[model samples]
Target: MKWFFKIVVLSILLQSFQCTDTDDNSGAIISAQLETKKQEIQNYINSFSCSESVGCGFIAFGSKPCGGPRSYLLFSNSVDLTKLQAMVKTYNDMDELYNVQTNAVSDCMFVAPPTEVKCMNGICTIIK
Candidate 1:
């Protein structure tokens, strides 16, 4: 999943570098299109999971926490354009449900939901 996205981005970046030798609007247009595609891919991914630790906070007492609620996703099988995906995430400290569509797929994809944050219960340390 992640590899596919990396390949796409890497290819775009490589193309950008390769374009410098030539003088034309082609490079700019290509980069812009590729970047837009990347953004679309990212938006589609966010519907599944958090790209990073988000809505971060912990359940603790007096600055010492025991546990915390983290963003999680239960993505369905591969996307079907004919259907919509039920996506959930924490918004304003509440669970927000969305029926968003899967727009695109990427080779270098990073599925969501990171582990416990670097800090646990107000204590900063390695999560591992």
Candidate 2:
């Protein structure tokens, strides 16, 4: 009876450890998904090109743990603005959720928005 009780307790302890491991794995999975989403946004932005005539614009991207965007993205106005905005929203939402879930910390420094955006050479550039 003593041996059986010890064995049961050990099994419970092992199960608890396994549960924590699963939680850690979930956090890693979320991080990976966030990175993938970020890359997707970048790829979409890259698909469009800007020239002096094409025009360029900037949009805030990603949510910080403390609030506000992590950074801004520059893109050509020739792209599908509606689709791009939707994708950014999705990515931001996921980023916010990931921050909350992982208890992510940030410097909480204010990121200034661009003073101007223009097409420099063949690419859209943000002039700080």
Candidate 3:
């Protein structure tokens, strides 16, 4: 009888733990968010025109348009404005500043302490 009670108690404890919601530790949710961000940046880069010398940069795009023509600050380093302008002209892309703003940051890190960015369509706005 004692062994039966012990088993029952252990089962109940296990069930309770299984039902608990620990979103902070959810790997799938985090992975999906990361993937979505990656797609947004990829699309933005693909559409942007920078000469072969300009290389690439990271950005946070929003899910919707950000009003009319405006300058965007990218989270990237070693960005050449001249090259970016050249690419924009070649690709007819919008004018956006990369790593030029005072509050610039990168979204390329996948390590602990995830980054939060608001991206819509091909426009990205950093949320610091």
The residue-level lDDT of candidate 1 at 58 comes to: 21
Each model's lDDT? 0.33, 0.89, 0.41
Clashing pairs in 2: none
Model 3 TM-score? 0.23
Candidate 2 residue 86 Cα shift, in angstroms, is: 0.4
For every model shown, what is its TM-score relative to the native structure? 0.20, 0.77, 0.23
lDDT of 1 by residue, 30-59 (tens): 334434543554365435431234323222
Worst lDDT window (10 residues) for model 1? 92-101
List where candidate 3 sits over 4 angstroms from the true fold. Answer: 1-28, 52-128
For candidate 3, write residues 35-80 as lDDT tens digits.
Answer: 4544554454556544334433443232112222222335323345
Better of 1 and 3 by lDDT: 3
lDDT of 2: 0.89
After superposition on all C-alphas, the RMSD of every candidate to the true structure, in Å, is 21.7, 4.5, 15.6
